[model samples]
Target: MAEPSITIRDNGPYVVTMPVEILDAKGNPLTITRERITLCRCGASNNKPFCDGTHNKINFESQVSA
Candidate 1:
């Protein structure tokens, strides 16, 4: 079983990137890929679940966790 992982970038429009396999409720893989994905953290992206450089206007801040 391969575990999925997400990476958060500080200098990019995407707050987080993850290689995911979309699955059904029963854990069946859907039509998804293992490619890198960008997620919006500023909550102002017209494209949900993806980053569109909307964070620049909102001045989003992220706290680094140790």
Candidate 2:
């Protein structure tokens, strides 16, 4: 099995490699149909928990490395 990976995009979302499950606050599962997923980080996406390019519109900035 391949290990999952996660990448943080510049001023954008968290790009996640799948075979993973995402649960809502209510513990309900969110449908994941893609090989990878883009999760919101800037808290501006109308589509909560997913990236809708709101970070670009809002000019969100972040510096992180690991």
Candidate 3:
């Protein structure tokens, strides 16, 4: 059986609700999921990739102007 994969939607807030196994660079399991998670993409988060509601402070927008 293959390991379960999580889908990350582009230009949107990445949310993870299900239990998942976090891994290290060497394919080793780092930690098991205990709660929900939200990741940031704007690079303005003080949490550095983790949602800390800081995106709102810097007016971080994910949509690109075409």
Best by TM-score: 2
Better of 1 and 2 by TM-score: 2
Q: Give the distance in Å from residue 66's predicted Cα in candidate 1 to where it truly belongs.
A: 3.1
Candidate 1 error regions (>4 Å): 1-3, 11-19, 23-34
lDDT string for model 1 (1-66, tens) is 335566566644443224455556788865545455677666788876568887777777774444
Using Cα atoms with residue i matched to residue i, what is each candidate's TM-score against the true structure?
A: 0.55, 0.89, 0.53
TM-score, candidate 3, is 0.53
- Candidate 3 lDDT over 1-66, as tens digits, reads 334444454454566665666566788964545466666766777764466877677776566443
Locate the minimum summed-lDDT window of 10 residues in model 1: 11-20
> Between which residue pairs do clashes occur in model 2?
none
- Tell me, what's the RMSD of every candidate? 4.7, 1.4, 5.2
Residue 1 error for model 3, in Å? 20
lDDT for each residue of candidate 2 in 1-66, tens digit (9 for 90 to 100) = 456888898878999998788899899999888888899999999998899988998999986788
Q: How many clashing pairs in candidate 1?
A: 0
Clashes of 2: 0
Model 1: which residue pairs collide?
none
Compared to the true structure, candidate 1 yields what TM-score?
0.55
